[model samples]
Target: MDADTPRRHDASPGQVPHDLLATAELVAGGALRSRDRMWRAGVALGRPLAYALPTTGAGSPPMAGAATLLLCFPFDLEEMPAGCGYRKIELAVTFDDESLRALDLQPGAGWAGPDGARVTAFGLGRNRLRWTFEAPRTGGTLSPDGRWAQAVLASPAPLTDVSGRVQVRGVIEHPLLSGTRAEGEVRTRDEVPFSLTRADVWAAAPLAGRTPRPGAWALTGHESIGPPGERLPPGRQHLCLAVDIEKYSTRGNADMIRLQRSLLRVMRAACARAAVDWDACGRQAQGDGYLLVLPPETDDTRAVPHLLDGLAGALAAVNREPHGGTRSPLRTRMRAAFHHGIVHEGDSGYAGSAVVELFRMLDADPLRALLADDQSTDLVVAFSDRTYQDLVPQGYEGLSPVGFKRTDIRVKQFAGVAWIRSHGHAGPPPPDLTAPV
Candidate 1:
């Protein structure tokens, strides 16, 4: 706590209660004794960690005037979109069944304060705190590995009670974000924001900050968050992945049902592990295939390899379970295609070369033939030529040039190149590609 921050030392907050929010609310807006509602002076616990809720202790007068709740999101600074980057943050922090008014802007690194370009923060209702952090424009990029995009909510002096859980919803605008990640669009949990596609991204700990103890404040649920303050140009760009089950139509209905159920679970688990929120993606589910137009902040290099690894690990787990008639060794062997490019959403369907390219790699005869040749492999993936060049050669974890073989695509009117990697590949096989040099 800075000396400049306002503080009142005449009173003291109650003992650390089980439900801090409930107690804080009463103290914030409800009536409380002079002793229960005043800040204790002489406390200087400067800044709290990204994932902690510091409390005031017993003394002549407690010093932590306002309780600060910090939320550490899974966003990496480099994953920010190139389209005039900005982050939309909406948080629900209330006392007395109403919104918690703002006190001071958190001067933490990697955040834009109130003076940001065209900020509409203070004008919003008290039910939620809304802000858009202006970021680098086109041709510039933000810092790398700065994964903690946090919201510091400090209580006001008059009512020194800020506690309990705060629900947060945030998105770095990439045009596709507003339509996809709009609050309440999907009545389910949002995946922690990260592009499973980046190499530098670190997995979020179960809690944020160095000091994590039971009953600490948690940033868990997100209710209704507002749209971004500034709108960017609408774009169809996305890092996309296409998946299809092998011989899906030939399977009996019983097996088909099992596969379908397993596919959904597989995707959910993969997204959870990758820090790629399922809601951030534009999903188009086919009976035997699926297309995921991933969030814009996802990087192909990190997400591609990470998602591929997730698919392999998760599919292996599914196959190990007793499935497909009397404990079969495997029941869900599938093929996936990875690509990053434009993907269009319309009133009826999605149309774009990116979509076409993804499917071409997925359904191409050679990629299918490889899957058929290696029946023991649980999953096979094909990366677009450009996508492969961007990732595997960069020597990222879980990706290797020697493990991938270039495959020629001759599906329909679309013809291109794809690099294939099958599960349990021993090494690079002899070149069998039919594509030209």
Candidate 2:
């Protein structure tokens, strides 16, 4: 450990912290100075530098003949040359045996320094690399939340020449890989196979059901209550925005997953922009849509319009742009319902009449008819009568009485009146459903 590197006085003599935990603070601080020096030293010595991977593997390194190496240099690609992202840093080496090995250039691995950088490999190449890195055409920069672009070496051929050190420097803006949109969704490149939220990773594995434990049991009125003591308190009044993608079931599983995720991104972004805390919001994922519960203190009257406006902008942008290499024009529309209700906080999720009404409003036939009737409309928003009376009449930034048509909503167990508005098209909703309640 360097002198400046803090020593853990908490650990007894033989107990050193894991290499990763030990250096996490340094890594987070963006201290690449020493990492660069180490890379340069490895280059001068003409030896392969060993970097620890995030996960553990079998003791033996995969054989050179059996496995290909991915040398990732996670750095800003734009700060470098035009072709630098695709440029391969050739390291001269005598392979124990050449069996058609291909190497990839990727963003730097953890603890790797700038300029004089370190390379870390996750696994051998499993598929052919494709050229996906492109600067944003919309004049957007990297995500303000610290998302970075990566330069991947597309199409791996057998490496013939390998020798010496290859230098990589700078950062560049690439097509949105990950970032927060104006709507507040964390946009991750669809090409990335999987993205896990911190909650996803840290979530406790599901048990069979509510685990019964030895505790103080109480009988309430006519039933036995929780062994933990009393039943959990009911969730406070919250603004619930329930959104569902139109024709979500029409697509195949793969496409459905993609579309749903995209919708979620937009929803999250919109909520964020509306001043609703993404992490704090009670999120319950349904198949094609979700139920997002805002805190009691949220200005629902102000928040709804902001969310809708941002949501419209986000959907428009996504719909206008081409995604991946698929020829299928990405098209999606949503039906959303805004309601306020107290939810019964459950171990798995929130419950209450509010949650039920929101879902019912989303699945309303009138909302469906509206989307089916207007080909250009990408989103339709409905406010429960209570919400409309409380917030809609306020003339918030993006809302107005004239903009919405009053409709009687009756779907499943839901019976109520709501005000509906459409985005991406100009016109009143179909007269059949908008008739006098």
Candidates in order: C-alpha RMSD to true structure: 22.4, 20.7
Write down the TM-score for model 1.
0.44
**Per-residue alpha-carbon lDDT of candidate 1 for residues 109-181, written as tens digits (9 for 90 to 100):** 3544333422233312242443333333432222322222234444434223333333333333232333332
Give the candidate number with the greatest lDDT. 1
lDDT of candidates 1 onward, in order? 0.48, 0.45
Q: After superposition, how far is residue 222 of candidate 1 from its true place, in Å?
A: 21
What candidate 2 gets wrong by more than 4 Å, as runs, is: 1-229, 425-437
Q: Which ten residues in a row have the lowest lDDT in candidate 2?
A: 17-26
Candidate 2 structure quality by residue, lDDT tens digits, 209-231: 42211111110111123567676
Q: List TM-scores for all candidates, in order.
A: 0.44, 0.49
